[model samples]
Target: MRRPQATPARVIVFGAGATGARVVRMLAESPEVGRVEVRDPDTARLRRTVDSCDDSVTAARGLEMPPDADMVVIATPTGTQAAAARAAVNAGASAVTTSSEISETRELLALGSLAAENGVALVVGAGFMPGLTCLLARAGAAEFDLVDEIHVAKAGTGGPACARQHHRALSSLAIDWRDGSWTRRSGGSGRELCWFPDPVAGRDCYRGALSDALLLVPAFEGVERVTARLAATRRDRLTAPLPMMRRPHPEGGVGAVRVELRGRRAARRHVAVLGAQARPAQGAAIVAAATALHLIGRADVSGAGGLASIRDTGRLLRAVADRGLRPCRFEGFTLSRDETPRP
Candidate 1:
């Protein structure tokens, strides 16, 4: 759970789907939360998930809501971050998001301003993958006094629905952040990165397919190079459906994340973080809900306004534990010709 601000907070999460519910469960069980409110366009789904919780949260549709909610977790797709951030701050609350690197939503740039104006925070890209990966980068950059390079890799089992959503539409442009500018890498232009030190699997690199490295590299500073590689369960030439636009309830599956940081150090080393939810409908709800409460409780979230990162979420796992959810495990080490652990 996030550490509490001076006053008890009430949180609202948009899009009451799988991940949203997880974030909610985390919030309801949190001591930091005074009242839990959930809002979604889908009233039926909202009612159903609310019933499962311990009578802590009041569920409502988008149009009707409580006087004020302290924080909002935008569990919507990648494209909706800007609108979601606006809605939450407008409603007198801070915001959190799962759209790791939502590029299409340029309106997010104004969140800092809105948050400043409202005296409430509007944070984005706080999901497990980018959020957690960024945390590792921060930890690494801090661990090593002088840093020159940074690299990140993630692999996981995606739901059939999310995969299909990827197929729903192809991202018109593949981009990343560089020196405060957006640079487009050719769509499907990246090469296969050999992943060697997965926490679950000791050392095996799979064929890591496409990603938005071009846009993200610039946003990350003090690094000579930064690469974020992704591995999904099935890699067809076909792209997965866009989760930002919509979320289709897919069949069951699991997913994991593995990241590495290489800089001025003697050798290229790997570090990993993993997250997975089984039983699509229920699991997704849990992820979303869990995310919401986690952010509202963070001390890092200044005056209830600003962007929050996954790296700032170790405390949230405590609430995950309260719900009997297991936090992702961390394991792995630098590789040397003779240092690889023997099976």
Candidate 2:
């Protein structure tokens, strides 16, 4: 006798923007997903997204999620994600959010108990920086005996909404976790030179109102310092306080994230660095899609949390790499025999 095939998952994505469209396409390609629906207020955008995907994909006009959906991917703008997530969980569907905003991430984390009660998972910060960065941090931390500090930096933006959010983030107050306390600093004030993967190499990064620390601190129990920064230009810092002078491009250029971990390994100070480069929207979409698939396959994952809370970082990273967002690790040059120092 042959075994019966399991029912495919029904996934609903909110937003027909760059990331949302990409997520729909990815999910449509997955054999595990049976139906994919995209919802957005903009009818034209919604139609375009649905038309771009496979025939199994459909378009919905509003924010409401159907109760039958197995998963809901919230690719909407930052402020709008929490509500969609709430509705999805209440309707008994697992939820995934790409939101990178601090406040919004906090709001989503608060849904942990609700999601657990409903026996559904809520994965927050499933986008590029907070998503991939968190995974890299966990991967690096695993090599350390005691991680003391984690610093994450990113370059470039995704869609227009992402560009706008980056602008606002530079103007808002930046938060840092230090010495078991939170510290606030003016955004764009602490500029530091950061080296990313090729094509986005060596840019000036500054403290920003990013949510990486919120996601990472909880995952790593004894980590004392955590900070996140964004690559910015002199003009970006100068103009951050003012309204955007022009409409952001429909999509930005190559974006990258660099994660650096400092800790003690074998009683000696050690550092591990990992990074990846891609179009921000594409990277975000890949992470979100991979996360949704992981959630679908794993019945053991239930509750709301960021990528840091994920049980299997290695597996998720491998899946993301398999999807083409390959991560690069920084391995310092080894000493030659001739160059070895005598004790």
Task: Give the candidate number with the greatest TM-score.
Answer: 2
Q: CA lDDT of each candidate? A: 0.50, 0.90
Off by over 4 Å in 1: 1-7, 63-66, 157-161, 168-172, 177-182, 194-220, 232-235, 238-252, 265-343
Worst 10 residues of 2 by lDDT: 334-343
Q: Which stretches of candidate 2 lie over 4 Å from their true place?
A: 1-5, 333-343
- Highest lDDT model number: 2
3-87 per-residue lDDT for model 2 (tens digits) = 2327898999998898999999999999989999889999999998888877999987666777688999999989999999999
Worst 10 residues of 1 by lDDT: 203-212
Model 1 has an lDDT value of 0.50
Candidate 2 yields a Cα-based lDDT of 0.90
Which lDDT value does model 2 have at 279? 99
